[model samples]
Target: MSNRGGVVKTLFKRDFVYTFYSWGFYVVLFAAFMISSFILKNFLDGIREEDILVSAYPLNYPLFISVIVISIYLVMLSGVSISREREHGTLEVLFYGPVTAGNFLISKYFKDLCLGIIALAFCAVYFYLVSLTTNLGFTAGLVRALVMGVFMISCVVCFGLFISSLTGRTRSSVLVLLAILGGFLALQFVHAALIGMEREALSTPMLYLRETVSHLFRGINWVSPFAFLNRGLDAVVLDSPLLFGLNIFYAVVYSVIFLILSIISMSLKGVKA
Candidate 1:
């Protein structure tokens, strides 16, 4: 096989062995699936209520679950990946390889991202199953979600690798990662507050300010991975599709930029083991 092909097999084999055979992996997979299924079932049943039916909308279900599953997968898998290597003392051992720093980093990033992508695929499956309950259908939404999710996963993996690279031990890295992740999540609530405040301030003659604020929110949405995923789907999945080609172009462009930064960051940081 060619060198690139060999690299592909080596990475794929390593990840499959590590993730599929590990008991911890199975536990996480089972729990996520079971909880997701239960929640979706409850949501479907709840839609029968008059008030709930009025609020029920397409992609609403997907958005709710995506945030939970994606966040957990990113933080937990990253922590677990690095912590396991540190526990086994394998990270230091791998530093002696013929692999360049870039190659090693790419391998780790790819492995983690693949695990996340696979999990997200299962998330998509759960989404499809739930959609069967109503007249709702999914196709374009799925494509955009998958594309955006992968891009986001790539970015998150880079963030995780940077955390892992900070020290020889994984515990410290995991703690720092959780701290950062929590802070980012809290920012979303802050955004909500800011938007509400702006609405009140612009309640008078500055009617155009409302539109300007809304447009600003849409533009700023590109920065957050979760925001982009939610916005892209929300814009396309609902009966009232808000974003068109221009908005999608913006999202795709941003994803590419984030992914490039991720690659560069990972390349610069060598894998110790």
Candidate 2:
């Protein structure tokens, strides 16, 4: 047990350092902060003097968006990590040591999770600075959303690992992930549009199509990590303890299931192509 722990820790440290030293990490942070700041500025500017916006957590939405932007980069990083290791023969070399498929995948997951938490810390600092300048009102809700962000990022990491385990090349892994996620998002949007339209205006074929898309969107909501994040954030916004707890539970289950699948896939596929 101690040996396994040491192996995981060593790999975790190695991956963490690699991720921290990478230029992409800093770029992701900068992009997330800039986008959040831009959105906040626009939101503040839209407020008229006579109009009052009474909200418990104004920054939560921006925080959610920022976390999501960071998540995209982190997920891709996680996917690339495994495929790069395998392609470069590092994974095969590491497997000669005490490392197993589970150990490797768990270490990658933890490294990415730690990075996500660090990103959330950076997010906290960013929001604090924004509050100092703009008074955006960082409430308890934002804190809850950040906490939820950690779990959401776990889901993303595990899902990325799952995709990485299936593909031998980093580019292929990323392309596959992008295609699937894009399909889910596209379906979601189309379903939402159909729902917003007047039902009477739709032809029978269109109605059937809308129903099919709606069903597909609902299924994707359970399968996609982004959907879990959105649901968790929505629960935070609504301040529903029950929904929040449920979402958290769902995220944990999602992460665990995908992590197991990733391990199994890696084991079956072997360390090297």
Which one is best on lDDT?
2
Residue-pair clashes per prediction, in order, are 1, 0
Please provide, for model 2 over 1-273, each residue's C-alpha lDDT reduced to its tens digit, 9 standing for 90 to 100: 698898999999988998899898999999999998888877787665536675668798789889999899988988777888899999999999889998888899999999999999999999988888877677888889999999999999998999999988888888998998898888888988999999999999999999998888888889999999989999998999999999989999999999999999999888885
- The residue pairs in collision within model 2 are none
Residue ranges of candidate 1 with Cα displaced over 4 Å: 1-5, 51-60, 63-67, 79-88, 132-147, 198-224, 238-273
lDDT of each: 0.58, 0.90
Question: lDDT score of model 1?
Answer: 0.58
RMSD of 2: 1.4
In candidate 1, list every pair of residues with a backbone clash. 91-273
- 1-273, model 1: which lDDT tens digit per residue? 866556655765786677757786556666766766676566666666543654434445544466446656665565455445656766546556554444555666677777777767776776677667554565565556555566556655655665565544566766776776665566556546556675556556465655565565565565545565565545555534346354456555764464455446434543443
The number of clashing residue pairs in model 2 is 0
